[model samples]
Target: MLRFLNCRCLLLAGLLLLAPTVQAARTILIFGDSLSAGYGIRQDAAWPALLAKRLHEKSLDYNVVNASISGETTSGGRARIDAALSRYSPQVVVLALGANDGLRGLPLAQLRDNLTAIVASAQSRKARVLLVGQRVPPNYGAYAIGFHDVFGAVARARKAALVDFLLDGVATQPKLFQADNLHPTAEAQPLLLDNVWRGLAPLLE
Candidate 1:
């Protein structure tokens, strides 16, 4: 009986030792706009989901919680950031907003401040941030330059990682985008994931 009791205790100890590893999947919260939300594609086909798949392929213990909305703006993301950080307590926060603000011709100053706040909020929670930049059509005029510059400025000032531009190569290719020519299509998801992973992979380590 004593031998059986010892065996049971050993089993319990082993299980207890493994519990934290099982429950401690590091989370990466992707807070963005339609681009990350899958817009015209299936949710599972989105770059965020692809990121999860890549993580599993490499045996990384991480979870990606995509909190993106189709029309979300920098201000909107800033407003909800604290609640998201509190809820997920993510190890990394991917800030991919501000596109809507640019599209709507919102004030660039407001966009910059909102992004700064979002980055600060995530960092305050001990979460590493990746700020994904956006670019507007040339028709929007010189305002586009300032809009594009905000991501780098915020990243540098706040000491955050940056993807530079989420749509980089894909943006110039008309075939890669949806009919609206704004959001990326399923075919472009992999490239988008690659662009983000270039910056995000380091944070995971």
Candidate 2:
């Protein structure tokens, strides 16, 4: 009888230990730019928020933290990453940066290095990374192509999933962009979430 009681107690303790692991929410950190920050729109209308809503709609156990700042560059992201990582303790980090750097015609090598370091830093914390690429405006000329390639190259090197062109469906589409032609309009938020979700959902499972 004592042996039976001991076995039941051990089984209960094992189930208790597994309960928290099964119910814990997965955390995703969106470390991005003005686009993700909802530059001119309300914060709740941003892509990150929309993504969170979508996750809820699907009944997924997850939470999203938006760490986007308008006009953020790779350098700026790298500088602030430690704090962001520390605060969020994310299981996954969505790295969407370098658009401002490309706009400023920053060197591609510098962008590559910054991005590589950022990915490595996140990996060191055992967090999975998803890199979101951005294309520079055509006015930047040949340098723009090179700048854009930095994202794919870094992602390939780091073995991180890449979301080619975060603004794929909205960029250069006047109807989807704000008056300045730099930010996505609220109407475009859903598509942006779709773009991110395509790359993010697979890794989540």
Highest-scoring model, TM-score? 1
lDDT of 2 at 60: 78
Give the runs in model 2 whose Cα sits over 4 Å from its true position. Answer: 1-24
Instruction: Give the runs in model 1 whose Cα sits over 4 Å from its true position.
Output: 1-24
RMSD of each: 15.2, 16.0
TM-score versus the correct structure, for each prediction: 0.87, 0.86
Across 1-205, the per-residue lDDT of candidate 1 in tens digits comes to: 0000000111110000111235546888889877777776777788888988888788888878888776777887889889988988989998988878887789989999999999999999999999988887777779988888988999999999988888878877878876665567899999999999999999997
Full-model lDDT for every candidate: 0.78, 0.76
Error of 1 at 173 (Å): 1.1
TM-score of 2: 0.86
